[model samples]
Target: MNQPEILQLFRVEEKRSKSSLRQLFAVVWAQLKMMLAYKSWLVMDLLSTLASVVMYYFVGLQVDPHQLSRSGWGTSYLAFSLVGVATSNYLWACLTRLSHSIQHEIRGGTLETIAVTPINMLMFFIGLTARGYLVSLIYLVGVFTVGVYGLGAKLSFTPQSLFVFIILFVLMLVSNQALGLVAAGIIMVYKRGDPLVFILAAVNEFLAGVLYPLELLKRFPALQVLSMLFPYTYALDGMRRVLILGASVFDVNVLTDILVLGVFSMLLVPLGLKMLGWGYDRIRREGTTSSY
Candidate 1:
């Protein structure tokens, strides 16, 4: 190719990348604005989170401090539960956003329009769910602030610990997105109920240690094996150790947790994307992309 032609191609590629980025940002921004406009819902969400913290705080008070200390999570059950709750918030956000996006578009008669668009499906879904992720982060912060300052829960953190926690959190999000994509893919083909999402949520809540410690399940070999299959188990456990126990990322157990989470993200993300694309193609071929 001529030098001028090569430069022209490079410029064209740059412009395309910029355009895709802009489209992603535009989708995220639109959802953010819609979230802000719903003032009452935001208020209720905050209030409900605070109420849960209060309930947990009281429950913590009833438990013996020595017992919690023996558990080795920390001296505070409130702090332990706060981390679980925060992680669960992210889970709820991921499942709801991804699983519902395709369904919502179909129900609103916009799926066909969206499907026909030139936008990347993964990027489009990421942008559409960005707002929910932001809201979930807000909820997490509010819960932590109330738990620590208002409810007398003690939380220990260092810069390194915080950085590691952030890394684990991002990995958790990616892993959850993988499951979300799978759920979305199933929805696209089935065109109706969300059995995958519901079943996974219920199973994770019990097995992944959302409301309790994974250590509690260790006595049951079968249950522990089942828990190990879910990525959230490692994510939540690692986060709790880092945030509540102030463990370093380099700690042997923590490192293993990180590796497990990384593997889950790496494996599940591609598989989920492939499954989603396959389902999308099937729906389009069958002339049911817009069906509900």
Candidate 2:
């Protein structure tokens, strides 16, 4: 190719890469700024974490912490519950934003502005999501650190377990996005989404073997299979196995978890984008795009 043509192509590629990076960071930074603006809300959020920890401690006193220890689950209930908290937060961040975010922006007149932007719509949505997702992750880290140091609980910071944990963490994010995409679709079409947001959140927290063992779901085969498909199930279990149980990366069902999460991500992205596009088209055709 000619020098001018080659230079033009390079410029185009470079711009695309820059735009992608910018979108990613922009979404995360915007959420952080918004969170910062509400100092009281942040305080409340932190306090809520503390409150949960206290409640857990009180209940731990009532029950035997060694119960899980005997089951070969983990060393302590605190270790078990902290991992649950982290995974649950990640799922909540992804699903909550997916279902309500666009509707929220649309009602606030922000959607109109976002729709007019020159960037790719999917990229923009992802950027917007990255904002809250990162904040939630930061909150999770704070909770974990406090649980480890403040409580003086045993936590593994081993390189091998850390590697496995990172892999599961990413898988968890992707699976969370799948649920988010479905919620976004419902919001776009129905104006009000299905009441599954709260239900899903509850399940992620209570059922997905987050605070307890998957064996608890054994009697309910359907529930077991359903929870098995959930990324939170693998994530909470994997975290406990690695960080508390001192298990190796090769010791857990890492492969199966990754496969399920990968499949969910592959399906959700295109579905979400299509849903958003369809919602936009429906609004345009019906001339209801502007009406909140």
Candidate 3:
């Protein structure tokens, strides 16, 4: 192609990209506005986050810091626990909380309206994920602060490490959101909302290494294998490597974890989308947009 022609094509592509981004931001903004409408619920969510920090603080006091640090962690017990707590809260927000939004719509018979919207379903779903991300960030900040002031843990502050940490954290978020989408698919098909959430929460409590190392599960090979598949397991460990252990991405086992999370997100997102579409079609065929 001639230079002029190529330039024109580039201009057109840029404009389209800008327009797509604008639309995505608009959708995200609308979802945030809807979330804000539930002011009391938002406050309660914040309080719950703060409560987690307080609970962890007291629990830390009961454990001997020397014993926790003696286990070759290099950091104080509070520092180690804070990373686990923050990442765990993010996992809960992304997976357990976000999974229920679509189910609520289905139960209220409003999911049909969503299917009819011209907005891209993928964009809409991801936009909704921002609410959970923001809520999780609130909790992370609270717990992290508690680790610093309430528990007297020193943080290693380096710009490069911070950037790498945030990137990995966001990738972990995407992976959890993908799992949430899968949970949403089950809700779409079976209309059963609470079971997956409960099961996942219980499993994470023991297996995600929130309070202990995964090596502690050696006696339970089946549980160990299952826990290895959870994105939160890697995320919690990676966060500790960055935030507490002062390890760079090159020094840490981040690549393997990132690869696993990437694969999960790439595979499950499409499957979940297809399943949700099928559920929407079924409801439309029955003319039950607003019917439970």
**Best lDDT among the predictions, by candidate number:** 1
Count of clashing residue pairs in every prediction: 0, 2, 0
Sort by lDDT, best first: 1, 2, 3
Compose the digit string of candidate 1's lDDT tens values, residues 1-292.
Answer: 9999988987783334437788898788888898899999999989998899898888877877777677678678888888888778888777667768778878888878876767777678778788779988888999989998888777766789889999989998999889888778878898765866877777886798876667768689999999989888889888888988888989887899899999999999998888888888898999997778
Candidate 3 C-alpha lDDT tens digits along 176-230: 7667766765565566666877688668756988877566677899999999878
Instruction: Please give the lDDT score at residue 291 for candidate 1.
Output: 77
Q: By the lDDT metric, which is better: model 1 or model 3?
A: 1
Which pairs clash in model 3?
none
Predicted structure with the largest TM-score when compared to the true one? 1
The CA lDDT of each predicted structure is: 0.83, 0.72, 0.71
Output the worst ten-in-a-row residue range by lDDT, candidate 3.
13-22
Whole-model lDDT, candidate 2?
Answer: 0.72
Preferred candidate (lDDT higher): 2 or 3: 2
Off by over 4 Å in 3: 1-23, 286-288
Of models 1 and 2, which has the larger TM-score? 1
